[model samples]
Target: MQGFSGRFKDLVRRLGVTLFGIFELLGLPRVPEKKDGEGRGKG
Candidate 1:
């Protein structure tokens, strides 16, 4: 039904936002051109 689909969409949107926040908290770097870049930098 229409209401069910709307609820599902909202749920998905909230989930996406929550996951993005968790990723941010975890310091996940976005994709880079090179495979071993950014997060894997030498200390």
Candidate 2:
């Protein structure tokens, strides 16, 4: 069961990567990830 779940997670991640690549080809900007420590001197 653990192995199956891990494989499923990998599949989803790969799908997301493919979709993001397509979006990039269409000239769409990827959303920036938020910093954990919001404001200490990092933009």
As a whole number from 0 to 100, the lDDT of residue 29 in candidate 1 is: 86
Clashing pairs in 1: none
Please give the lDDT score at residue 9 for candidate 1.
96
Off by over 4 Å in 1: 30-43
lDDT of 2 by residue, 1-43 (tens): 5598899999999999999999989878856767997656754
* Stretches of candidate 2 exceeding 4 Å from the true structure: 29-43
Clashes of each: 0, 0
The residue-by-residue lDDT of candidate 1 on 1-43, one tens digit each, is: 5598899999999999999999999878875476655467676
- Report lDDT (CA) for all predictions: 0.85, 0.86
Cα lDDT of candidate 2 equals: 0.86
Q: What does the lDDT come to for candidate 1?
A: 0.85
